[model samples]
Target: MPARRRQQGPRRLEEFAFINLIKRRFGRVPRRVAMGIGDDAAVVRGPSTRDWVVTTDLLAEDVHFSLDTTSFDDLGYKAAAANLSDIAAMGGSPTYLLIALAIPTTLSQSDLSRLYQGLHRACRPHHVALIGGDTSSSRAGLFLTITLIGEIARGRAVLRSGARPGDLLYVSGTLGESQAGLMLLGKALTRGIRRGLAPADRARLIGRHRRPTPRVALGEALASRRLATAMIDLSDGLSGDLAHLCEESRVGALLDRSALPLSPALRRFAALAGSSAESLALQGGEDYELLFTLSPRHEAAVQRLGRQLRVPVTNIGRMMPARFGMKERDRHGSLKDLAVTSYRHFT
Candidate 1:
């Protein structure tokens, strides 16, 4: 999974910094890889013709979700989708999935079945198989950890380190709706009263959060055409994920606020909630959209590719030199530093 780093936090070792510590402590673990530690997935040398892309994600009850807002079916589907998004980021086709679950004894068998149904539904379209997994009883709540394996042509895995200073930054699909959906799911704190929303809008926003689509076809298309210079999925929101990409590639980014994609539902929700859609677009997590960089000259080809795939790819920013850091131009033509307020586990 991509790192969920927040801009502000208490006195503690941050997630990525902790990751770096692990990398240093276990630096001699003797694992051969094409890429490791810092990207969406770890690429390992596999067969003569292809390489393996592997990633894992863990979702804990209360910490990641609650039975109050999420159903068993939606939970299972989102878990699978999250892992699939990782493979999408690596530009690989998912092959197998293994789930390790710590289930509470109180959960009914029917609920468990619904969970598995969700997992199956997500994997079926991509032709991926649930090879094997482990189950154990938990005194606490449910804890699910999924490990996914994927494959790509040898030496063809796209990475976060490939972005250059001049590459254009693009994202597929609209942003911020998932976050809006999550807000609607919970008791939204708007002037200490529940705001009435249209039934259709409510359903749409909730669905976005519950069932995010992994951009498998878009990722494959970009990889096959050699279009993207660097790629990442928007799991941790645009601000943090883009920061991760810039840090890895030693580049910076300048975002055009007007270019940020906003869905109509999100705009309406933002207005009702007394917030801006742009804030939600930048700070919301689990959007699962792909953020990639492309050279300026290939813009036309990518636009055509987006049309062919039926995925809207928007050019929202441009990569810049590292010294410039990450900044954004507001709609009013004012420049300011882009703050990363995405979800972070410890914060």
Candidate 2:
């Protein structure tokens, strides 16, 4: 019998790899491409009336998560959820996705299968089909890049730049839970395997960090009603994400500390960690919630949407003149500089 041929270094990178290689080869990047590598999907000008919204996101081991703390399935679900959140921010419905996975040779086939299963579990409900992708081996850690495609009706896409002064600010759900969950997991891990936690607590915290649900329905609702003047996903903490919306809109905002929502679990965890819950609420990332703005006239409509969606649409504050800059009120009623800080790639 012929001996099995030794495996080559890396199979000629296909699909996205080839596309990216071509782009690199060219000195110029396409301007018509509406979205590129850093988001959930890539948007491009199509022949149709609607503009395609595209974004891509990458989750890597150690940088984004660790295997000790996160399960393979949770990691897969989160990788896709992050991209889907970007689509929701653009006021679009997710249509298709391309997945690129780089795995270490040590990982078993069963582990890889669980990871893919997680991706399918997250995508199928949103009607996002996994159309194409590429796979490669990496010596370092696991890396997943998901490219999502969405569509917005002509002239109907909500951007971060459209908010004007007096526009009310709103968020879809409570904040800080994911951060709290992470803290709980870390504590449990540090205490070693013997200092066990209740199954329920472990499930709750782990689930929060692993399976964040993007507010796709709320985003579509906002688009359909044309109620949101500007919109974005609160992926990188409320403070950071809200700052993004304000910067894009060329306006500033003030969030009442009391008005910021926090889950009970997060509050309890914060107390246990000897940290301020407000700080986590401000800077904690990966909430996967929606932050939007609307005119006063649309307040009732937006509130009605909250009722329908069973999600709280809290009006935390209003947009101010761009020159005023962003600030948030402290419990002592003092105006403190609210700096925009979030997950920055390469920072």
Reference-based lDDT, each prediction: 0.81, 0.75
Q: Give the per-residue lDDT of model 1 (tens digit) for 2-72.
A: 22222233312343343444344323322445554455544554667888889999999988888877889
Candidate 2 displacement at residue 281 in angstroms: 0.8
Candidate 2 per-residue C-alpha lDDT over 1-347 given as tens digits, one digit per residue, 9 for 90 to 100: 00111223544433234345323422243465555433444554464888778999888888888888778878878888988889888788887677777778777766766776777778777766554455677889988888888888877878999999999988888887786677666754355331344456556655777798888888888986799999999778888888889888999897788788887666666665667778888888888889999999999999999999898888888899998888888878898778667843211
Best by lDDT: 1
Candidate 1: give the clashing pairs.
Answer: none
Reference-based lDDT, residue 236, model 1: 89
Error of 2 at 134 (Å): 0.6
Candidate 2 Cα misplacement greater than 4 A, ranges: 1-47, 187-202, 343-347
